[model samples]
Target: MASNTFERFDLESSQEWKPYIARFRQYMISQKCDQTLYTAHLITAVSNRVYKLMCTLCHPNKPENTEFEALVEIVANHFGPKGSVVAARYEFRKREQRLDENITGFIHQLQLLAQRCEFDDKLEENLRDQLAAGVASDAIRQSLFMEKNLNFTRAKEIALNMEAAANTCKIGKENTIDNKAKINTSSTKSARRSSSRCWRCGRIHDEEPDDCPYLQFKCNICTEKGHLAKMCPQSASKLTPYNTRKREGYVKKRYHTRFSNYFGSDSDSGSEQSEVQVIVRKKNKKRQLRYVKK
Candidate 1:
């Protein structure tokens, strides 16, 4: 095995002395180190200042001369007193999932906190209740509430699934909103282009329609000198909504003969005349009825 297994003791690190020492023992076990040399290894693992402090703690007796358990106890006492049982449990119970923490991290944090709490055989039960009670998501919490005979495994599974699904949905919704905003922006650009587009020649520029670049452009189809082929009134293939215009002329009011759809001057269709006008041609100058079919 390689020489370096465990890192040196770090008081400034987030890991407490107890957990650090526990991990050091596991490392020693993995290395198949002799139990008698554990105290010696522990002595070298600490920093210079820590080794001096340990020597002082040993007093007349040398650190290497002591038992492993005794040296550990001495070091632990020097570091800090054991925490209260009530305080540890209170801290464990109060721990809720933080806003930036994910489900896996939150559950791991709970497990760490539960170590100090002496729930014994009811550890799983306490964990389950605490997880359900203090979950960050209300949907997960409520699902746990409605769940029948919810255990730690079941509760954790449900909470994780719910959290994952909610996150995916939130991402999808944000992406959808972004896509809609982009489409709206594209449509706005298109509208601006159309607004500045010239109807006479289909050229786009920031100018009025009458001041278009094609003011003197000739029409290819109609041979018009002042308009393009698309804007030529004589073009038969130019039927479009823009080409259709409302006529403001009035139709001549006249009576149609009901004899055989002939245009005379009287009819039983109605007595009151509508505001209709029609152009008539003079033939014999006696007002001859001209029958026109639409």
Candidate 2:
């Protein structure tokens, strides 16, 4: 075979000897290339750097004269990386199905780890145990654990079938895969506005807003139109001295509030609710009075 026909081996690159030689062997078998050609094929396919190194290694005898099997064995022994058995086994044991990965992909990863681990006669048993213990789905793991005489092949079969069935069911039931968290907004939204704070005027309204003493309502809290200082959003977010301090110490607070509806249907009714009362207190503890209308 021509040198360019196969990938050139460069010691500087990440190219691995095992896979490179495996591919060459496969091509040779398919082409029915003679065993005699294998030695020449390997020598011809390597880069100049590798070839020069091989020449030095062969010394008095040329590399071409070197037996193909001996040449391959010599090069592999020189450059092929040695793997740690314990490390490989640790990785194999730690291998679990990833969130986005399927059972097949997970199993393929396990198989790769198994090759490096050298489980030998117990390879199947080890694979079976890892598959059962490390499957992503609790149902699949439980099923495998409960199965009688579960082998590697049987575990793989069960996992694939379960995965396919789950995917099919999900596809048929819209695209949603898992539940997401949400706020309990219904409980909060359904709550009614208390009679203490009026929307039109600032005070607690006994009934309708149209009867509010301050019909041209403007909130002092938010400086907004159509709402009272008591109904301001800015007023609602933080604890006001009104409710926080006054209501907290119901007995000690010298502050007193009178409702707009405190007066009867007598002539003082409209004048009474619309009465603007002033409170004298510390600037920090200051609170605006709210009037309730019809």
Candidate 3:
């Protein structure tokens, strides 16, 4: 038995040890083995860890329930004295590949380890399951957002808050996301407020009159209309005191005299002619009076 064991080991020793060790390490890491093998010596020691997982998956007896440790034991049982680390790695990869596919199916099975774990409410539980299955947070949140009243942004906020709480019960510390959202809301409100246009000037402002220039008639003066006070034809023709004196109907009053004070300094040359006629009428009246007395 000792001769056979030595011969079997010698065969493995003939293979390039460093490359074999490197290849085996890659296999283990890719397979997601818990314990790492640093050297070829350690590979032989830790080789059983891989075979143990395979045994647990393949075996039916005593397979009531198996944790990571039970799987490790099964992997160790397979890495027996007859197999070399290099040969064992190839076989390990084959088994792990099948297990990887089954892992996806098993997660959805709802029978293996579902009831053992405590679940959050439906929302959180579904999110957790999706993340475990490598689904993105944004994708899940977007899907939830399609539901009634579940906006994407709001759902993301809830998820981020929940994660922050789970990490370290520190509420409101991760509120930077909320602060940006507030800035957006304020910006929208400002945009809405700025939409009002002024009544008099068609310019954007905080408020507009009910009778804005665009809606109501324009001022006649500014728009050159018939009835604006500044542009009224009646006002243009209305005379001032100076213009009234220049008109034909104006009769100038003497300083402190009546019509008998005909030779007034205020009269022009034509006014003097009217005074002479008045004197002639008085003379004619005197003649008539004298004849009556005779």
Candidate 4:
């Protein structure tokens, strides 16, 4: 591994001490750094403020005489695990990702917490369950649950692939919706342009001919083409016919009055005189018709 990987191991807070020391020890072993130089490497890897503070409190004697195990114990006592293993396990169980947290970062955090819990044969199973539980996507969780013989490595790979596919699908759907919106906007503009053209004269205007007085040529009264309501022939015909129906009603009323005069003009006799009035009115109507013709 690169030397820069150890940079993040610099302990800044008490919570980081456990994982930091564990990773540092692994790095030292892999690099085959001499056990005599462990203290020097530890001091170099930590932050300047922590190293200075440790030097003042821990190195009261000569720095070369300080035992490695004593220094490790002192650091562990101040910043290592404070509670029992059971409490650590409980915290690991409750570990979850926030809504805005990244999935891979959350899994890595769970793995770090699991190390402190000291899970053995059940470590991969526990990590898998926690990984699935803390994932923000339900699709990945369900996919993990459906697997028969899933281990941590395979589960992680599947989850990553599923997350990537979901992001791609979301982007595609958004692009499709944007394209549809553009198409609908263009279609609406075309419809508005078409509606502004007059159907009768084939001329374009700001409004349709039915609503625009300058563009409209049909008569409103007669509903005919090529004329306005002011010059409509049906307008004069409508005025002339208005009193015709009223005059007809007046003539019928006069005829009924003549029948009533000849019939005895009594309310009780109306039913008995109706038949005679009908016969006499019909004969008088025919004679009046002949006199009018002459």
Candidate 5:
């Protein structure tokens, strides 16, 4: 097996010493370094401050030499998870997944925080609860809560599946609504096109009615076919007074007959007679007609 080079350790930045030492230990294990040379190798890899401290404690002139196990314990006591437990717990409790954040990223964050907590057997259960609490979606939370045997691995799987399903459903609904809007817009355009009337001939057509053959034959004033009355020079003169009076009498007689039928009255003598005067007012002129009903 190839040996891995150990990175030098720093003592001034005590916060990073724990992981640094852990990695150094792993490298030592892989290299199968002997216990007798463990302290010597560790002393060689550390910064000046740590190197001087180790030299003072394990010098040959000293009364006592520090053991490798005791050195490890001293480093751990000074820089290990003990000092970070409260901060880790605070962060874990405050951790919450954002709606836009992926569930994988949120779960990974929870895992890192759980490591610092050092919950022992309760680690898995605490991780599960944190995972459930941090999820942005209520549906996923409900699904996780419904599980009787929830664990970190199972919770991750279920939460991922639920988040995916929710996204799919949201996309489907948006697509459906978009399709409906498009259909409605297309139908409105079709209806408007179908109901369109040509300005020239005043008739509905697929194309403009200006080119129609009947357009030239139709009259504007009388609305008749075959000729335009306005263009015709031989127009009829106005009616005479005698003909006008005769036309008025005919209209008056027609109105009386229609009203009598509507009232269902036949015996002229027994029924009471009432006069309904209709006044036709136009501009500044007024014309009145008296209808006698029995």
Candidate 6:
């Protein structure tokens, strides 16, 4: 609704700078660039030059944050018609300090001016008045010093507004149904038939089965229709070579003692000694008897 949305930053009083700056600081804080974000004066100088060129092309009745098309016109006028300002700014700023305070001040002033005009109000009037009064004019002219009065606070406020607008405009994914992969009743059968085709064998099949032409091995080990080899407890063990089915009758090793459940009747059990005996007889009629396990 407002073509001149950027005109609100100009203020008629120097006192307005404080509130303006406060708002800008708030914006910078919100953007998370309050202290962390820093740029060399070279880039600032170039941007300043480009912005000036753009302003000249627009010839706006007053300071304003020009639209994209206006900016394009300015850039075209600079490079395509008038001359290349980028090269000049680059050449000039290269000799200056990268963090030149003068450059920073100029950058800040331009931003303040832009901010002053970015909204649909007379905020720029105050800024223009301060400029005309020559108060801190040198600082404002200095690209580095101008940074002190940035309009980040207002910009951040504007950003927040834009973010809120975006949120309102958003169609949340939770509520929206994804149309991708949606099936049409007419094509259901065809889609399914096409998808069932075996990609590896290039064979069109309705299913994945052991008898499928794409089947790999013919060994019983590979047959899992009635039983899987790994799951077949009766299968021969590679470690023993004995079929587990055949070894079913064999007793597994038992850890319990045969006499463990048979407790002695009295203290006589302690004195009682169990023994095993063996006898050896030689051809010379010599006999030997050995008793063990006492």
Which consecutive 10 residues in model 1 have the weakest lDDT in total? 238-247
lDDT of each: 0.77, 0.75, 0.40, 0.67, 0.69, 0.39
Q: For model 2, how does the per-residue alpha-carbon lDDT over 1-294 read when each residue is reduced to its tens digit?
A: 333487778889899988899998887887778889898988878888998888877778778999988888778867865679999999999999999999999999999889989889999999999999889999999899899998999999999999999999888666443221123453333343333456676666554567677777677877777777766777656432332234332322222334455645643654543433334345465655543343
Instruction: Report the lDDT tens digits of candidate 6 across residue range 151-247.
Output: 5344333334444554565655423434333445436766686577453344566655444554553235545443334433444332232222223
Better TM-score candidate (1, 5): 5
Candidate 5 clashes between residue pairs 3 or more apart in a chain or in different chains = none
lDDT of 1 by residue, 100-176 (tens): 99989999999999987888999999999999878888889989999998899999899999999999999999999
Model 1, position 63, has a per-residue lDDT of: 85
Lowest summed lDDT window (length 10), candidate 6: 36-45
- Alpha-carbon RMSD, each predicted model: 13.6, 11.5, 24.0, 13.8, 12.1, 26.9
Error of 1 at 269 (Å): 58
Q: Write the per-residue lDDT of candidate 4 for residues 1-294, one digit (tens) a residue.
A: 225346544455544666677777888888887888877777767777777667665766633357766776676777653668898899998998777776788888998898778789999989988888778788888999899898999999998898788889999999999999999998888788766755544556555556555434666877877546665666545332111122432332111211243334444453432221111133345322211100
lDDT of 5 by residue, 45-67 (tens): 77787766655654553212567
Judged by TM-score, which candidate is best? 5
Candidate scoring better on TM-score of 4 and 5: 5
Question: Over 4 Å off in model 6, which ranges?
Answer: 1-110, 114-159, 164-206, 209-294
Evaluate model 2: give its lDDT.
Answer: 0.75
Off by over 4 Å in 2: 1-7, 10-15, 55-66, 99-101, 120-122, 163-294
Displacement of residue 264 (Cα, Å) in model 6 is 91
